[model samples]
Target chain A: MSADATQRAPQGRTLSAAPGSAGLARRAWPWLVAIVAALLLPWLFFDWSTHRHSGFALTMLSEIGLMAIFALSFNMQMGQAGLLSFGHAILFGLGGYCAAHTMNAVKAGAMWLPVELVPLVGGLGGLLFGVLFGYVATKQRATAFAMITMGLGELVAACALMFMGFFGGEGGISTDRVIGISLFGVSYSSSWQVYCLVVAWTAIAVLLMRLQTQTPLGRMANATRDNFERAQFVGYDPRMVRFCQFALSGFFAGIGGGLYAIVYEIVTFDTVAAAKSATALLAAYIGGAGGFFGPFLGTIVVVLLQSGVSLLSNAWLLYVGVLFIVMVMYAPGGLVGIIAQHAPIARAGRLRELIVPYVRILLPGAFSVFGFVLLVELASFTTIGAAQGKAFKIGPQAVDPATAFPWLLGAAALIGGGLWLRLEARGFRARWDALMADAKAKGVML
Target chain B: MEVFLVSLLNGLVYGMLLFMLASGLTLILSMMGVLNFAHASAYMLGAYFAFTISQYIGFWPALVLAPLLCGTIGAAIEMYGLRRVHRNGHIAELLFTFGLALIIEKVVQMTWGLIPVPYRIPAGLDFPLFTVYGTQFPAYRAFMLLISALMFGAIWLGLTRTRIGLVIQAALHHPEMVGALGHNVPRVFTTVFAAGTALAGLAGVIGGNYHVTEPAMAFTMGPIVFVVVVFGGLGSLTGCFIASLLMGLIQTFAVVLDYSVADLLKWFGFTVTSATPFHEVLTVPLPRIGALLPYVLLVLILVFRPRGLMGTRDT
Candidate 1:
């Protein structure tokens, strides 16, 4: 059974009740807020120096939007259907290849397709492959299912490398996204314009995926995930539900891939590699696969770390691996789940009581994170960095890792902060329990 | 004929190495239900550990010491890491191992640097054993075969003869029942996990010298080992052996075959050209397509026969 299934009670039969407009508005507001926030973000990071928009911010935001779509699509399998796929990137990359080909065709005057519809072309490509591969992949459940997906992933990845005509071998296929065509009198040249396209598509993809979860098919997928034998007894073919979910996920992944192709104007074998698939898995799982917008948040955080943190340290992947392992072991609900766990306390207005405890833990937590990063950086610099002539710098002070003092300081900070954090965490947990008991006494049941 | 014989012998050597890795994996998968993504990482660790140890104490001592160290590390991981994450279900366990695989690879890179180490065969075993027509077969490969055959015998004896082995055999099929019968199931789990890692380490000790002992060797060998285990049929040692040998032979022979689908089309009197749809795919030589055969075979087996060739369970 899925991890989330044990934590929550089985949802009641509310599928038959039609959602009222008020209920619809309650659901729609989050998307509205998201859309408004996305539109306003580029402006917030505008650069006034060169009189040009912030290319870095726009590109990063665009990447975040694309990755969000990818992770959300991945969640359809993992979070909803309980189908863990290691080959979802196949659809995304296939979609990208299709979009790239379409762009080339348009540039060659062989086709008159609008740039806006290219993502749709990518989705179609994803759907085609999803149906083809899903039939074989969905035949097994649990470990077998995971293994089959991995095999398919490897098969497609190998094919992508060998079949140079379409995949373009190692260098991959590149095309011009501009195409000299105007859609709504906006010539697509600037990174900002591409960011607009990504936002629009990401919103559509997210809304569509959310709507999908409300449908009977979506509920059936959850039913299948929870108990396949029970789902079978209820006259539903679990395989069919899995197949549909897998195909739909492919379509969304393809849309994400389409945006990727459009933004970069190139698609490579790396786009469809196992590493890219792992990224989707990491983002979705870390963000909290149990919630709708969990993957979106996870994607933004991961992309930020991938872009921002990678700039400062070489041990960024190591940090991500540690973070992912920590999440899996301790917080299976992910970052979103942790926030949602405190929803009742916030509603009961008892959230203020936890502030002191949270700060107590937070200070030590920050210190530990800093200390851990310092140790990793010092080790990395001494080994790999020094070879490349890179020096470790903190503000105005440049510390040489070869010196015994720096090593002692790093070790002291890490050990000291780690011990302090552990102590703080225990106290915080105790205080949290007290707050929970007080809230329960007040009849604010959680 | 010479090419065929040389390839066959080479394939057998490679197959035995694969079986050493897959046998351990098959046992772990049956018992734990985890794919053990870090299995190959353990193998890589074995290779690296051997390289480090052999540098100081020579190859003979390193062979025994490296695998023992790997087994201890495996036991520690199971006791601390896997035991902590076990309550989250198989997916979490799998993810934990996947993360561990990444961390291991990174750590390996950090410790050894990102390049192939000179972990070659010992000077005593460097010479060729015999000449097959014009081709030479190395004594080191014969040594690998001898080591693997001894391991196979040892594993077989330990499983059938010892009391712990019998308990492990029982737990492999019906773990809960064994646990209910008052056998220390968790201890058995740790032992089995450690043994599996040790076997992988042993494979690495020998295979690394035959191949290159590089940081990326884990990733390069990881998928192929999975293919062997899956193709052999989950939880069946005999099936794993057969699948390993078959895959090894197929991969070896495919590299020697230069023909393609276009050649078959030519025999059928079909005039194929560049204008033909899927022309590239048809005309590609089998040798060039060798890298894809295992994956293709894996998919076909999973789709057509989910139980694998000799698997009793539905994998």
Candidate 2:
């Protein structure tokens, strides 16, 4: 039915990166730019006096890189095949364990393997398990598919905790990343060196995933997603398509996990936890699961919110959850979808026409958002911060949550700003509709 | 034998709680085709609300009011949230609920803090009810059973005797046709969802003190309830009840038995020493892997029988 919905809304942009009329370079520029940006990111955070990158910045960037792969792989099942897997971390974590174990084996002098290609070992591990699990899980589709995946995830996580021989129990398995076996003689001792590996692998994984969408397997996946019965009628086994896509997605997820094991020098049961799976889902959905690069973009933002925002406030998850729900209800297309939706107007030279309307909405939107955040943070502070002996302060003044003043100010701002935003949103919508109409009349929008 | 009896009694209490939560989820999953991921979150909310209300009022009033408040919240979520996402399709709706679950957890944290609240068993029911195998069974367990049994009877009477229940039953089987017959199917959905959540809330009110009233409780209990629903088969209340009890007994027995496949194998003359391949799995105790059993059962059932026992629909 969801597939049917997507089919009905086909404005022929299912394959947004149409190979026709566009040169290869034009289509490839985004990747090129992204790669350059990623390469320079760590250096921008480098400390000249210490001759080192800020460990936090490097770690965060590396997380975004690998998590981008993970989130994208999650989308392979979700957006591509219309299969919602609740336990994607089964593959990701399994891959990490395999990679970690292999790394340990190398350290123990049992096997000689390049440290650089460890992600492939992880990929293989993921593929094998994906094949095994996908065989069982792909037997059912829709809701059942989700349930089975969830069960499988929980099963694996439980196993990870119980099986100390492999999972290493609560403390988890840790390793030194300076496994001197790289082709380039890169010992991978430094965090910067590991970050480079992450960047390279992330690039490869992203490129391969992008190319996968242009392949027959990818098309069949989309075909099955759009209409399962029709795909079956067209002599394609929707089950087989789902199975292959599931396995391949696992391979990519495993690669991400492999990199995770390397970057962190450990893989814990947390890798396979249900929360880990939720992270992928959050990234993919919030980024807008519709586009190839949507989840990739979403992963970057989600990881930032997770790693960066948590520093300032204990209510980061609340922010992410609120953002997620708001995105689901209002912007189902996600960040990528939002951008894709506006591409036509941007191309039509009438893009500037939306500036006034946008300003009208942004002011009140900011006001309400600020109020919401303040309220949420204050609420969180009373419970967590106050317990930790951290007082809620406004510059020189310490604010008390038990007092009525802050609460009233927060409530008043929230209510007033919400009403103002609502009023302005109406006008914004009208203006946006008119612009869209004008653009469509000018043969700009598809 | 004493251990068996005590575990059996304990399992019954746990099973009853699981059924209360799974019942609502089974209804939502089997009928509406929307898995209410926040069902357990609603249960958590009930505990929180009950705890706060119990502090101000008392446990008895809190028990009655908490579920009602949860039901109201469920109704609002259905009307405002699920209704909007319903047009987008099941995946969107699922995501919406998933987001709701996360939000509920965060909200619970923000409001109550991360610590477990003092939602304890009331003094009246805190005493032991009876001696079972020389061990006293707490009166709280008995109270849980009594409440659940009373709830079951009420639900049975209401559904069997009322016109609205008849409409709901019909709508469950034939939602579109029922809608065509001038019944508000969405309203039925809202009512059922609210009822289901309220049931979960009621379970929380009873079970929270028995366990712990904490935000993490929702997540810990969420998956097991799901496993129950899937095992019981979709759209079948009878199957759900049976599955819930079966899982409860299995989980409880697994913990108490202290038996393992290693022991069984040892009886069969195959010693599972550390020298043996995969010794870790072969020698692991049942209690160690108790958490894995329900999920293992779930996957096996899903693979072998898409439609659970007595299931009308292929889940």
Candidate 3:
């Protein structure tokens, strides 16, 4: 599946770029802008009125950066290598645990390591586990590989619980990051300081991963992913390519885990759990595994939903699951692929042609989403919320769920809005088809 | 002796429940090349549906109705959801099911509340069936064994005896050939998927009461079922049965074995002190490690014998 998507990747690039060095520069520009943006974001979001930092914002931003690295690392196996690892977070978690240990050692003055280089220690720890497990995991392909990774993940997670010295059992290992160690004589005491560290590591990790995609090893990994037989016939050991890629992916994931440990000052079994692995998969796939920055965007969007949406409702995971299913079913190339598909049309200045159609589709679409959310929330409120002594309140009105009025409204909105959305969607499809034909006639191709 | 007899019976019951779930998964994985990650979720739904139905109409009627309901839901999902995603590839199908599993868990929680429903065996069958070494064996367990045995017989007969079963068997081995032979392959796919889910639902009906019908039961059982299917290898029912029974026995026996690796090492005069390397790993009791056994075995099997015991296909 990924093989088919990667085959069309160059075509995606061709829509917006000229060949040669100009295209290279165009590609490189995003990385530079991303780095600059990462560096400037904390300052940009500074609170002037309080005369104090927005620690929450900084922490959230740091989480995004950390998740971005994790997702990107995951994509190395998933998109580029076509190895769907079900246990990618083991490396991340192991790295975090190792980093936590390092933090403790540094705090005890038993180690002279600087705090800035802690993530590298984590990366090395990840690489160690990655190589060890990758040797076994990379022996198989596809489903078997995925299963083996899951087994390994479970094994490590179980061990993490069993061995308390290194893993610290259920409560996990915690450490103080403000251990009087300085990188450039800066105490690194504040969340912003940690956020800066995360941003720097994220930038480095992203750049390294992007660079890896251009290397011979990366190209071979893609070739191996596409066809193991073909790769083998061409004198490349597909297993070796997979192993190296897996190890490297683990290394980067470990770095992300290190950042997580450093920021949180703790590492636990949750870090290496299958759920954590699922998070990486969701982020990478939702963002567009086919694109370099797709997971980056996915990380931001998912982290926002996780941190932002979860505060208001307990159905955040439900929403993410729904979004993922929708993406997989309808848009396998993900968010970036959807956007990239319109590049030629946008470049031809015919983008406005679909505005009416988009509005037509989106109006009922919004209604459907709202209806669905309302139904889910009401159901949740009736069952769980009521039991918890929380009333269902919307603005000034406290709606009693026992009444049939709200239920009717929810059902009608869902069924009615869904039907209307279907109708509008057909109209939008017709308009889109017409616009595509027009674009084709105007010498614009997608 | 009583402990051994009881553990054996319990193991058999649990193994059969696992087989009911794993058999469907094996068929889906081998025939469609799509691992239905939401298979356990289907089981969860069956339990929830049975719980609700039994509350209204009693257990006996629910036993017949809940699986049928699940079969219908499974058919709808296959027709609308899996069929749409099938064009994309197996990975998409897998992800779709994975997402479905998540949604189902959440939906189950929302609809049924967060707590486990008091879904219990019927009073008619709640009494002890027999006494073994002065220990009473529950009649519900005997019923579970009977139902599972009946299901096994039915599935075996249907697959080997019926016309549709022949078509399904043919489809499993040669899907493209079956398609070329003017068979409605999509219909067959849907039927197989529905049948698989129905079997899972049936397992849920029995297993839920045997264990507990809760929101978290799906997640807890999901991985174990996957391990069974993988350990048995893909596309082989006999292997699945063997793996399930072996896993069941291992888990049950592990729980009963109070000894640790330290005990074993003591026979060789090796004392496991606190300062000793891997002391926790060595001293941890067998029952404490029971949860990790299946995963460890799964890894070992995948690494060593990828085709699994009696499996014709490599997973």
Candidate 4:
């Protein structure tokens, strides 16, 4: 079945770069501006008028930055190499552990090292582990790779418990980030400081990863993802490409882990658990798997859901699950993909022409979303509410349990909105098909 | 010797229980080419459903009803959820199942709470069946063994003697040919998924009382079941059976044997003391090794033989 599926998929033919003169300066400006903006971000937070000028926001931002790097690293494997790993936390956690232990050793006067260099130790640690495991894992692709990674993850986690000197048994390791010498007399004591450091590293890593996508190695990895035999026939060793990608991914993941250690001031088994790995997978996929910044956008959205949504409902997991399912079924390319579908229309100066259809489709979509949220919130209020021994109260009155009005209304909205969406989708497709046919025929005349 | 015999018996019982679960899993994995991360979640639901139903009716009815309920649920999932996600690709299907497992875990917790419920062995099978070295083997264990053995026999008979079983066997080797022979492939997939989940549910019905019925039980058992499936080989039931028995014996004997590497070293005229650099590892007890053994076995299998023991193709 898989062999047939692979055969049916278009082989990795190079995509025609959108025909245009080289926009070297235009492409370079966004990254340059982003780097400068990242550098000034910490300082900007010091302004009193800014709402996010606080310790908590800075810490949250740091966490987001770190996780974004981790997600990008995961994208390298899943998006580029076509390996679906569920145990990426092995690399991330090992990186954190290595950094923490190194910090501890430095504190004990066993070694003298600056905190800036500590992340390198962590990166090297991840690199070593990845190479050792990736050697065996890279021999097999797809499901076998996933299985091997899972086994290695479990082994490492179990060993962490057995060996207290390394993993600290379960409590993990804690160390002060201020132990090592500060760069340029900047004391690395505050979350804001860590935020600046992480953003700087994240920007660099993203830049490096983007460049990698343009490299021969990256192209080979893409080919390998399409077909190992094809890659072999083309004289590129698929295993070597996979191994290199895996190790580089570990480097970035390790940096993310170091930031984790720096932010939380502690590292534990939870940091490297399979659940954490699953979260990375979720974020990368939710963002869109094809583009460079897909995981970055996904990270922001997921972290928001994790931080903000969890406060209102314990069923946040249910919502995320539903979102993932919807994405897989309807929007396999993710949020980026949904947006990308309209790109050509906008490029052809027909942007305004679709506004009516867009709003028409969006209204039903919004209604459906609202209805879905209502159901989730109501369910949460019932289950988690009932669990917490809280009653369903509205203002001064507790709602009667026997009434079916709320459920009926929600159901009506769901069914009605869903039907409206189907009707709108048909209209949208008809218009889109007409536009495409016009473009093709006109291009021939031109 | 008595302890050894008792542990061996216990291992055999555990192995049989695992066989009930792994056999179903191996079939579904091989035929459908999905790992079914939610298989253990389905097992968990079966136990909870049986517990709930037993309150309304009785244990006997629940033993029959819960599996039917689970089978229907499995068929619905395969038809609606899996088939939809199947279009995107295998990884997406896996992710969907993974999410489904997460949601099911949460659902079980929301419905049943976090505490382990009292799902006791039937009163008829509560007494001790045998005594060995002052250790009593409960009649419930014997009944479990009997049920599992009967299940194995029934499955074997069904596969060997039934037409559907013949189709399934042919599908294992020549899925395309089976389809060409007028078998509805999608219907077969749905049936296999339902049957596999039903088998898991059956195991849950019988084993829930023997183990604790809790929300966390699925997570605890899920990985071990995966280990069995992977270690056994992706496309082979006989390998699954042997792997299950091997794991069962390893886990059972690991708890039974009260020795460490230090003990072996002492027997070899090398007295290990606390001062040794490797004392932490050498002196660690055998029970701790139990948890690590499955992963060790997994790594070894993945590294040395990616295709597994009875696999026709690499998983």
Candidate 5:
């Protein structure tokens, strides 16, 4: 995650055009359209798509929204604030537990408030916990900070299981969201209805957090992150900046957690587990931690990979680990960095000229992808499927996995496709370089 | 009294096991500046490896070979994976280790299956050692104590008496200086990492049969090991030892005692029922909340003393 931001520092700094500049305006339109499309997605699915209103979409959407919030909140620390938290899920879980208890209280007639307003309680709960935890956590930065956060998270998670009053014990606690405020005169009985709430909260949180990046506090936090000694010499307390940022990030995470509680209507120990913390870390890292939207994009990609890929392979985590390692070592800026690398080309208005090259590259790429997928599927079918007492079939042919023929076929495809892709990539790069050189000589920027 | 004595003995045994894991972790962490989230996973691998090897050879042979296998794996990881990610800085290094941890878990699960492997004590060491205040202490526990003590002594000698150990001790304080002095720092790192992982593996080999050798064993033991490492401080071996034993004792003793917060409240003339707001907390006893005690101490230590007990520098 830090890799993305660190790499982008030189890029973002050197290219610090004004926010409202023409170049910026032109570049921002796609993002604006993307956000609009995202917001209008449920409506599009409800009205047009055949599989729009299925339970899967709603669940996926809820997951995306919650994780986006979590990732963005994580970015506040990792990207803007420069704190690498290994266990940011403490605030998320705290918010969840608080929301659970609040809902339970409401159910028991302890407090009367609309469900829409109840997330505020959760947010505040998170904010308070963040403040308390952050005060100590921010006393030291870097590795110490990471350790403290991890320790706190583990401690809280354990407490949640041990102390039944607050954490609801192992059985967890459930609440009803149906009794909450009627947004647009609609009680959230369905996942789609709940999605509306999620979208609204996600938007608000994202917007507010974006605004925070524009604030002096956020800028100072970045400065402090870049060079703490320099910041201290320049009359700013780095610790205070980190502390405030930690609390704010916790607030956003808490809001996300509240949304989680509302959607699931039940919160369990898994909600606050180390795996969840790792999820936010993965999402933020994969999307590219350089920009506000990087983590959001990462969350989408990760969730898609998580839900989509996990179904196909039990070794999905293995793939994720490999991806993370590769990204850290090679593409430090993640997907965003890859995109940002094309800035020079994009700015010269030569983006359209690369279409042929992209297509040329796509042939081997598609083959490589197919070969990889086949190998993964074959392996999964042999190992996991075998364990589950399932077998692979080809119409009337139920091939035995123990056969050498299948293994050889899979291996051949992988090797052949990989070699082909390597050759193709080299050819494409050579052609592109020649074209760019010719264009430069001809004085045709496009 | 018997319960208390038994709990103390159990806690001491657990603490010693924790030390074996945490001491190596402290060495690697302090010298190389890595938390090594996979340390417990290495321990788990040790257990699994022993279980596999013991199937053919004897338990005693498996004990020697399993840790060596684990140490080699650690060396491979440090050389291939970690060294490559090191250039990206500490966070990347951490993430790399974390990813390694996940992959290892999945791979172990794939190889071993989800069920707990019954890696029992050898018949020679299966009997009770003695009775402590009417509570029997198993021969295996005594064997564990002896082994840990031997490991501790060996580690002490390696650091104090041998040339390579002296190089490592210097590297612990000034890694770059050691490198400049012509002692291979990377070699030292590999050795320390291997040694640490070997310790963890050895602990797992012993604790596996003492506890259970399930795939989920890593996750269960991971946090406690971390707690011990943190509590012991980042660089200090003595601190690690004290912290490990303290944590072990606390957890064990807590599990033996059944008194809860409500018990204290009752003594203060307060009548409590299920309707109380804090009834859940009050009803849960120290023994039942044993799992939480380590984390609680970890947090307290982190908040109050971020450098940890006897740590020379902040982690």
Candidate 6:
């Protein structure tokens, strides 16, 4: 509890923050705002006439909550400890497996555990594996560390399929979530009840993670990341720092996995696959590894692109890959960095000045994106979509993939709009630089 | 004895193919200190390109042209993408390649759909080379081995006997000094990357038909190549070659020789049942765990010998 208070101290000490009572509210405001938003978000998607909620929206929100915790735990390694883990899903999948087994035990009347605390079981599972693997993986640093984790991940994923006893092989383990032993005697079965629990666990996990980041171990991890030799000189073992960070990150990841198992009621080898590990890396990196909230922000974008955009497009993976490449090349600091860049403009109260430039850029940007998507859809329709007997339709009309006209239009729009966006982008950069310089000169930004 | 000979021959062929990919990877790793994660993509692209090209000009032309095309693409990637990311750091460069891998897989899926393409052995090379315990070893396997052998000789000669190779060898260890000596190091980096990718492409051209040609081939091949690379120790081609062959033999023989830990224990007079602590592990046939051997080898090597069999530096 005291550790939590100490961590919250830094949250109230920013330059724009007020002192004393005002600072307390300022510190509390974002959490308050987030809590209210979390509560109100599902209502917006409610169908009043049906007297029911959008199951899809609720499920997606729950997914986002789980992935947010997972991705944030990943950030503790990638961003804080400077470890690029290619096999993080091992911890998560193990946690889910543990939780699923526990839930089954409870159902079979062999265990007396309440359903709400299953995530803790998952966390413990994750922590155990993290310790076991971290010892081997953290023996080396940088690229070697990455390779070891990759090897470990492959080993575990392969093991998951090979060993049917624990992992249940190809079929996977499933359990009934309604364990009938809730603290409040609530026999939780509905998606609403599960979603509420997800929200609460996400809050607790996020808070614990925030607190963990302020501890001496976290600081030492950072120190090692920046310069391990110097950290060694200062009497800290870089390897031990990395090991602890990896283990702790696993603990949090396991919590997320527990929630996943609870919500989905099953865990598969797919959970331990390289793709799942890549998800955490993608969410953390695309969100921004610099800030505490970056992974959460990234989780929303990634899950939206994954779960939401996937429903509409056959070429969603292509979009994700392209987005990742573009971000790595252009916005290495990620979406958080892009948003954070405007802090000076916001502080100077001149955010509106760039609105016109943004609008100007948006037009051609939309044009190019539309053109690209058209080409992608046309190609997709020619192949997989055609195989599935689906035609590419624009509103009431079906567009023939064999025709040259759509191709010509897509190519022309992509070329022309790309050139136009480039010109507009140049102008935007100039405007942004000028505004940023003015703000810096006026002492509105540092 | 006959089964062992056939497996050994098959393993040697497979190992040479792996070495072709690993050699290119080693070249780039030693030269630029950047692990090109998309090397497998290049291999996949080579197979696809060959499949498409063979439809137009026949297999012989495709065998020549596919690698060239792969080299050109590799050069372009190096010039436009990798050169820019080089300033950011090795991790960014690696991530950039990782992104390329994802994109290439999706593009291949989009272009060819998800099924395997018919990139088969040409009529000329489809004949059986010799009798191998009644299972005829196709002439295509021999051709793959021949090409890989030729590549090995050429690579060795180029590195040892040529002027550019010597410069590259120097740059492998001392890139800054090589640059200070007025060598255009970036051009050297580009050349090596192109050459390395071309080698992988060549391997793909031959190996694709020898195996299956599919969209997922890159991903399936990606990890094992990485295992070979790590097991060989980075920056050491010889280590890579030895490790590849060892992995090949291990994988090949693991399939043919099906025994379990339980069997081995039983041979030592220990009675075993499902009640054993690791019954799941012990009872499973070695063939069942064939997919896991290379990774297990890699992990054990990293834990026991980080430098691997014959590397100058630690992993």
- Give stretches of model 5 more than 4 Å off: A1-32, A39-52, A100-112, A348-389, A393-398, A404-446, B132-134, B266-271, B275-277
Off by over 4 Å in 4: A1-24, A35-52, A385-412, A436-446
Backbone clashes per model, in order?
Answer: 0, 0, 0, 0, 2, 0
Residue-wise C-alpha lDDT for candidate 6, range A255-344, written one tens digit per residue: 999999999999999999999998888888788888889989988988998888777667777887787888788888888988989877
Deviation of model 6 at A181, angstroms: 0.6
Runs off by more than 4 Å, candidate 1: A1-26
> DockQ for model 5?
0.53
* Interface DockQ of each model: 0.66, 0.82, 0.75, 0.58, 0.53, 0.76
A225-344 per-residue lDDT for model 2 (tens digits): 999899999999899999999999999999999999999999999999999999999999889999998998889889999999898688887888888999999999999999898866
Put down candidate 4 lDDT per residue, A307-425, tens digits, no spaces.
Answer: 77776667677767777667777788888887887654544446577888889999998878777766656666665566676666444776643367666666777888999999999
The 0-to-1 C-alpha lDDT of every candidate, in the order given, reads: 0.88, 0.89, 0.88, 0.81, 0.82, 0.88
DockQ of 3: 0.75
Which 10 consecutive residues of model 4 chain A have the lowest summed lDDT? A7-16
Off by over 4 Å in 6: A1-25
lDDT of 5 by residue, A112-187 (tens): 8778866777788789998999997898788777877877887777787776666778988888888755546778
RMSD per prediction, one decimal?
A: 3.9, 4.1, 3.8, 5.5, 5.0, 3.7
* Ordered list by lDDT, greatest first: 2, 3, 6, 1, 5, 4
Superposition-based RMSD of candidate 2 using all C-alpha atoms, in angstroms: 4.1
Q: Model 3, which residues run further than 4 Å from truth?
A: A1-29, A43-45
Q: Between 3 and 5, whose DockQ is larger? A: 3
lDDT of 3 by residue, B222-254 (tens): 888889998888778888999889888888989
Q: Which candidate number has the best TM-score?
A: 6
Tens-digit lDDT track of model 5 for B246-306: 9988888877778888988999998779889878777877776777777677667777787
